[model samples]
Structure formats: C-alpha cells, structure tokens
Target: MATEHPAKARAPHRRPFQVATGVLGDLMFTTGVLLALLVAYSLWWTDVTVARHTGVAAEHLRQRWSAAAPAAPPTGTADTAVPPRFEADDGIGFLHVPAMGVGYQVLIKIGTGEDTLAEGVAGAYTNPYSSAMPWEPQGNFALAAHRDGHGAKFHDLDVLKPGDPLVVETRDRWYVYRVDATLPKTSKHDTGVIAPVPTGSPYTVPGRYITLTTCTPVYTSLYRMAVWGSLVREQPVDPDRTPPPELRKEDPSNG
Candidate 1:
C-alpha cells in the first residue's frame, strides 16, 4: 500500500464583516475615551489652574497698591487725591456680583485680550468701550469672561435678573449697577452689544453702562450671552466703610 500523508491543516478565513466590526469597535472605544478626557480637563483641571493664577494676581494687585500708597500730608496741606490710570494687564478693580455669587469677587484686568484673560477673571474689551471706566463720565465698560473654564468667572451669569446687583470697586469708589436687561443669545461678532449704547438695548442716550459678555449655552461658543445695566449708584470709598448691603448676603430665599 502507498504511504499517505495527512492533508495539510488550513488556517480559518475571517469574513469581511467580522474584520470590519472589530476595527470599528476599537475606533469607537478610543473616541469615547478621548471625549471623556476632554470634558474632565475643561470642567475640573482648568478651574483649578485658573483659581491659583487668580490668587497670585490678587496678591500682586494688593502689594502694588500698598507700595504706591502716599504718606499723610502735614496739617494745612490739601488731600489732593488723584484717580488711578490702569495699564494693560494691570488689575483695575474688583467685580462683585451678589445674585450670581455672594462672596465671589474677580479681578478686572485692563485689556480683554488673551493675556489679561489668562491672568485673572474678566478683562475690559479693547475696542469701542475699552477706554471707558467705571469712574468715567459716559461710556460702556464692556467686560468678557469664560462661562465654563479658565476661572469660569461668569458661569452662573444666566441667573441674573432685573434688579440684581452688580458692583465694581476701584481705589476711590464703588460703582453700582442694576441688571436692566439680559440678551440670552446674540451673534458672537455682534460688536453692537458692546457699543456705547448697546444696539438692541433700551438705552437711547449715552450713559454710564456696564456690559458683561460670556459664551452661551454652557460649553458651546456659537453665541454670546450678555447682561447689560446702567450705573445707578456710586460712592467714594472710605477705609472704615463696609461693602454695600448686597455683597454681605445671598439668596437663601431662592432655595
């Protein structure tokens, strides 16, 4: 009888669907993981980083102001006080919001550009209204800040309603503003909202206005949410005086 060899064993062949399914599953899993990581970094890591920067910026501002403090004049000399001229990146004032945040305060840096935003909280817009200050006579003091991350300074801005309190503190005085109106959705490039008299706002005559801008609808940058108000009260600062009644409390009643 002739010698016979066992037929050679053959490798199994995979169907096209089986191969495609495996590859697709791997791609989906990887995409999901990356998305989750991005969300964590936005909601958690950026806040932590920005908070530390804000603290350092705040201390620096206090030190600069203290060093520049003038000595008391001799009897018979006039007080002759002068207002401060803020430069780019300089901490000009503190933004205080009661309804949105009771004890929270953020530094208002000079320029609303990227560098100032990276430094602390909100910055004054550099276009039409940048030169306008809380102490100035008539113009809008436009401000911009992040809604979710990078200090998330204006995260709860949506909660503001008519009559809410908004105040800015400078070396000499406190400028108080009342929430007159809110525009929930506006085109990002609509610079009119930051105009001397915001285009769609109620004000007709030029006045001391405050316009606060932030990205709208939580995480998307598709539109802007604005809160506009007019200057209602201003009082010279005194060493012994405490903040206005609004700053010392919260909306426990809202709960």
Candidate 2:
C-alpha cells in the first residue's frame, strides 16, 4: 500500500529536425527544375512558334511572287535563270535537301539574326561576312540555320552524303547543287569555309558553291558542321516540268 505500483513511463515524442543544409538542398532542386523547363521551352515551344511563322512567311512569298509574275513569255532555249530577290522581312527562297529526308524544305531568309533564324529559315550571311547569292556564277552561297532548336532547320544536315542534291528554288529558277564534302567539326569562328572558294573544301578553285552550316554534335555549338556543295545545274522554273530527278528521289541516306 505504501509503495503503489510503479508509475508507467511514456516514450518521448520525437520530431524531425532541420539540418544545416536542408534549405540549400531545396534551393538546388528548384533551380534544376527551372533549367529543365527552360530547355523544354526552347525545344518544344520555339518549334511550334517557328512553324507558324514559317507558314506565314511562305504564304507571303507566294503572294508576292504571284503578283510579280507576268504572263509566261515563251522562254527560248537559253539559261533563263532569274536572280533571287531577298526580302528583309520575307522569304528569299526555299531549300530542298532530299538526302536529309523526304519532303524536306526550308525557306531561306535574309539575315542570320536570332529572330530570323528562329523562324525556321536559312539565314544568308551578310554584314562583317557575306555569301554568294544563288545567282552568282562563281562564289559561295553559305547559309546557316539552327541544328538543334529553333526549328532545327539543319538538324539532318549531317546525314547528307556526298552527291546528295541540295536544291534552291527561287522565283524563276531552281539552282541545283551537289553535296561535295562535309566538315564534321570546326571552329565556330572559321569564316574561310564560307569563302568564295571555301578553303579546305574538295575544290580549291573558285566555283558556284553552297555551304550549309549548323551547330555540330546535334545539341551543342562547341563546333560547326558544314556541308559544301557545287552548283550542278540551274533549272529554269517551269510549271510543266517537275522537280529534278535528284530532288524527286527518296532519302538516299536511307537507301
């Protein structure tokens, strides 16, 4: 009776305690999520917007060309190559690279600025650098576009093998070029590849050339990847005649 039953003991309540680095860990995780979202926006959202802009640009070009075209005069048996007109705000021409893929085409624009290239079009080099126009008899018409994002116009450029047809369609002519060589890696500042003779190319003499350039390794810009081509023939625009056989062919890289 004097000593009652031993008093029952209760376990102590335990609660999680914040570590010294808990806040830092949370901050790091949040930053990672933001970066991922940015990438997704660049890769997906930009593509959707560029596609719409490209459609608009192509339509505007069609309308302008249609208005400028007069009743087809009898084109005599001669080189009826019409000079391509470049518009600062419109498409200059359309590129068709069959070896890259079937139904592959991209509009060529005037400037290589971020806004212009983001529209899913090839940008002609100008200012501090220049490129030969498609109508040029002997020069390099070098162009650049995105390889990984912002429409990725030249994503499949690396797939093009030598001799693949690279067609440039202007208002009144189709300048056909044949892929001569490709440079898988080169300095981004190397401007010689866009030269009239395109140094380091298979040919050293001046000739009608076209150089397609984009970032290399698919997703990084540490280096540039270039595809050089020589003008094979200039096909006069004809409503009756279909595209050249080279352009009509399926993806040669596949077969």
Model 1: lDDT to the true structure: 0.81
For model 2, residues 211-242, the per-residue Cα lDDT tens digits are 99999887788999889999988767676435
Among all windows of 10 consecutive residues in model 2, the one with the lowest summed lDDT is 70-79
Q: What is the C-alpha local distance difference test score of each model?
A: 0.81, 0.81
Model 1: residues >4 Å from true position, as ranges?
A: 1-14, 70-80, 251-255
Q: What local lDDT score does residue 190 receive in model 2, on the 0 to 100 scale?
A: 91
Model 1, 21-83: lDDT tens per residue?
999999999999999998977678878988998998787876775666653332332223545
- Give the distance in Å from residue 66's predicted Cα in candidate 1 to where it truly belongs: 3.3
Provide the TM-score for each candidate, comma-separated. Answer: 0.85, 0.84
